[model samples]
Target chain A: MSCAKPLSWETLVDWWAADLDEAGTSSVEEHLLGCDVCSAVARRVAATAEALRSMVPPVVRPEQLAEMFRRGVRILENPIAPGQTCDFHFPKNADLAVHVLGGLALAPGASVEVTLRSLASGTVLGHVEDAPFDAQRGAVYLACQRDYAQLDHDLVAEVRVGKDRPAARYTILHHW
Target chain B: MLSASDTVVPSRWYRLGSMMTEATDSALLAAIAAGGAGRREAERALCRRYAPRIRLYGLRHLRDEDRGRDLVQTVLLGVLEASREGRVREPEQLVRFVLGTCRNAVLRLRELEGRAQPATDEVLVAAAGGEAPRDPVNAAVLLRCLGSLGDRARRVLELSFHEELESEEVATRLALSRGNVRVIRHRALAALRACLDAPARGAA
Candidate 1:
């Protein structure tokens, strides 16, 4: 609070990002340690960062999936082509169940969407708009807690690109 | 962002603190030095205000949560002991003391890891010192806020924070420029903070 010109959110975020050069880092910490105003902002941002790190979204990126594997987390990946009904049996060691909806011809500049629905109850398990799609690989990935899907009912992942209707629907029949 | 060029510091600040209304840091330091009945309470008060900053410092610099917690305990203990022995001449400079202790402790830790790594004079040290009283964010609220973001923003944060990816790596994975990634990532986090701060304001 002693600072007349306090650090902005952008600067604090940059600090939170921790990607700044050495000088940038020093400047931020120098001001942060001295300026109570900036310290308050940085604290909230840091807490949010802590929460974000612990969070596992329904969707994940390739690097995230890879990191999970590196951490020794077991994953059961079911690669299903469009309109294919894949029978997935989650191994006892599996922590995550991934459904890769492949074979979608994503046109350039297309906004991809993914929906995970329960086949029996018609419950929408999850939905992601602006899903990150691999245009070159022609695929979209949907992941969920493996233990949650150990049931008699089937689960289906539908993928759509810049369209109201799904271009690809891959069904997952979970066999515990 | 305050670059290395923005060096108009008021003082070498170690006074960045919380729980300010109850007592001044100098008072707390004086209490500990006197070793009266309130000495233990004063030490706890001081630690409560500064432990979060030190823990955060340990986490980012040492790159380990356990190490961060370790650093907080170690540094606070040093502060407490030094205060009791009247070794700390300037109670006002505890912030500087804590920050310096963290660096020293970290250096000792590095030495223990086998031969000191090159002190490449990296920014990791300063960036990690960002501190505030530890606040527990509501998990349900955070998830709800997270659910509001676009998939790209959420993925960006996941990769950056959880996966511990550099901006360059995240940019490469998402096919975004490094600057773009930083902007998007912070904006999402800022919104989350705003949302969390909103209800607290109303309640308060």
Candidate 2:
């Protein structure tokens, strides 16, 4: 039989986010202990959250990046200065494949975009338009998971802002 | 549209809940605490009911799969011991008792993991979680789902989980109200669930 008393997804998310209070927590646990159906739903929500938790977006803020370090997520940080080139070797069991594009003179409050394109064939590997800027270092951090990293090809970060010319460019060589 | 039916439940749980002779939580506790011929059976039933719940608690608090499994066994053993010793303060409120035990266990675990002085007197909020299997969501499929998310949804998730930020911090960072963040996260999670539930194009 289906669960007669099902908790809402919003409640489950709040529970996962630690947003629920004492009464809410008890109610969920009580429901879970009694209703197998609701328990199953809660599991899916958790699994989905876990999947997202382990993933590294195309771009992340410095604090988010540091949180990965705190979580022991192995990151292969490729810091390449604009107009400079460095190779990438995605080590085994790597979680984050980051390319820190440094030495940009972006105007404050300007939206940064990093369009990754292959150097040899000029094919666009991926276009990550949402970038987090480090105003102090004048850098833009661009990243994705290790699975998205292509091997044995030099690529360029065609950095730009909305409807503007290239602000800066960084090159990444291939390795591993 | 995301409801309890959105994902497939393990058959074992269904069997546990559907058994005709199943007793209520209070009855199970009374039997276990009363101590007699029906005690073992009651304890087994109790474990069947709450093992998954406690494991989920461990997953949320401890954040490790092995630890989650450990918690299921540990809590079951603790409950059994508590029943045998007649130490269950409120047999009627066994859910709270179990939850309290789970919290204490997590605090002890944190202490062992080098985070000194687990809070003994702190009033903890009851934050329940879900049963996490060894292989949960398919990573590749989930990545596709995440990629299909809108910028705002994706950013909300990133802020919530990636940065481990609370609702207020996430709201401040994303420039959305806390209520808005919750709604977006809920909708985005439902969307991801839909994508995850759909048959993979390449799957046979």
Candidate 3:
């Protein structure tokens, strides 16, 4: 059997994986009948693509969103131990409002910084530093403005242990 | 004039032009330009339309859901600020701008953590696919084939397929003409098909 061109075996595999139409299927059938190397490459690519498609993570939940907000509020209200990081998840379309409560473990005169960043574009939405931290009642009150609400990206709130490293990172969904 | 069934299908470019007409981005841009009530409505529409896609894109890049969401919010605000300043004129431009920003953000995070090789292709493949191939040898071959694509082509494929953007939207955001976008997309798809079908041809 004569082939039109000596298409590389690798190229053929790429074509087969991408092609879903009749022409592509027929071409593959013809190639398989005439070439052994191409057939193996095709099978491998298909299997791998299939395997990769299955690993996407499931969606976030409301409870996770509430917890993430609560944790962010906590970190902003109290000082966290250096090197300790918290991860909080946000559910889609949940309110962005958060309330901080006072806790006895927080130290007096400790300041909190709330930095909101986008996970998609890695942009900083808002960064408020030296926000008053009241250790007395173990609570600080702060409101997430709608200014950050227009974003279509996922948000990450990083509460630094001090001025250096993060004490906790909370994910919040911005819904307008 | 032709009957509906007999009429030639509109070209991708034509479809894209029409899509652009109703695009939320365009409306947002107009609202931003107009200011006031129109601006508020456009901004809201922008948030509704792009937020989920942005979140998903962020998740894919950052591998952390919370971080991705935060990034989406920040990018949107930045876009709004730029719009307010008359810096951005087109909604399609926002997509590229956001993705470019995302790339930078991920790089910064990696640097801050001092982690070399942020994440492996295997991890992305796994994240994209799920459970590692039951057969390691076959998986390795597949990875090699995907790696063969040039970075630009790979990115185009991801933006078109993974991001689920229409061809015209992809073209507009990428600043390419619609025809060019279709061609590139076609070539990329062809490449993927070739890579997958190579084994069968070899066997022949």
lDDT of each: 0.70, 0.70, 0.48
Question: Residue by residue across B86-169, what tens digits does model 1's lDDT show?
Answer: 888787877777777878988987778633332221222322233433456554455556656777887788788867789999
Q: DockQ of every model listed? A: 0.26, 0.33, 0.02
Mind listing the fnat for each candidate?
A: 0.38, 0.34, 0.01
Q: What's the residue-level lDDT of B121 in candidate 1?
A: 18
- Residue A168 CA displacement from its true place in model 2, Å: 3.7
Instruction: Report residue A26 deviation for candidate 3 (angstroms).
Output: 30
Best by DockQ: 2
By TM-score, the candidates rank as 2, 1, 3
Query: Native-vs-model 2 lDDT?
Result: 0.70
lDDT: worst 10-residue window of model 1 chain B: B119-128
Looking at model 1, residue A13 earns an lDDT score of: 73
After superposing candidate 2, which stretches have Cα over 4 Å from the reference? A60-97, A100-111, A116-146, A149-156, A161-176, B1-45, B62-70, B86-93, B107-140, B199-204
Tell me the docking grade of candidate 3: incorrect
